[model samples]
Target: MTAWVRGRVQGVGFRWWTRARALELGLTGWAANLRDGRVEVVAEGPRESCEKLLAALRGGDTPGEVEGVVERWSDAKRSMVGFVEK
Candidate 1:
């Protein structure tokens, strides 16, 4: 699954927070800051776990306000080992 998180997502430790969250959920992928001030995240794991992460992302964590979350699902290409901030 790939997600684009908008609104107050850049800086404020958003990438780190997302990395930790994904790791906690045992999801593997990456999160990175976009030029348009959005955060792009790609994660692969159990459907339920991915859903949980999406919920949390939409709800926002500390220091960042999650204005929106847009997601797209696709078939897994390569297996990921750990979540990271890219």
Candidate 2:
């Protein structure tokens, strides 16, 4: 799944937070900051895990405030080795 998280998402360790959360959930993909001041995350793993990540993103912790989350689901590609911040 790919998600674009909006609102106070940049410059606040949001990418690192996402990496940690995804790693904790044993997911593999990457998270990056977009030029439009959003965070783009791509993760692949168990469906449940991905959903959990999405939920966590919605309930963003300190240093970030998640105003909205736009998600797109696709066929899981086990190509990613580990979670990364880009």
Candidate 3:
């Protein structure tokens, strides 16, 4: 599944936080900053792993404040080589 997260998701180590969680959960995906001050996440993995990713993205163990989250399920067609910041 893929998610397009918005709100104060930039300049606050949001990408790095996501990268760590994705790696820890063995998820394959890419996360980057959007020009519109939002964060874009494309991830694929086991169903459980994807759930964990969603939880983290929605506010897991991270110290940052996640005011809100916008989630969407996609085709999972994209293959992630590595988690990156863009």
Each model's C-alpha lDDT?
0.89, 0.92, 0.78
Q: Worst ten-residue run, lDDT, model 1? A: 58-67
Candidate 3 local lDDT, 17-84, one digit each (tens)? 88888889888888888898778887788778888888887764554566667777766665567677
Best by the lDDT measure: 2
Model 2: per-residue lDDT, tens digit, 1-86? 99999999899899998999999999999999999999999999999999999999987573578899999999987888999999
Off by over 4 Å in 2: none
TM for every model, in the order presented, reads 0.93, 0.95, 0.83
Which segments of model 1 are wrong by more than 4 Å? none
Give residue 4's error in model 2 in angstroms. Answer: 0.3
Q: Sorted on TM-score, highest at the top, how do the candidates line up?
A: 2, 1, 3
List model 1 lDDT by residue over 1-86, tens digit each.
99999999887899999888899999999999999999999999988899988988987454588888899998877678899898
TM-score of 3: 0.83
User: Relative to the unseen true structure, what is the C-alpha lDDT of residue 48 in candidate 3, on a scale of 0 to 100?
Assistant: 86
Which RMSD does model 1 reach against the true structure?
A: 1.1
Candidate of highest TM-score:
2
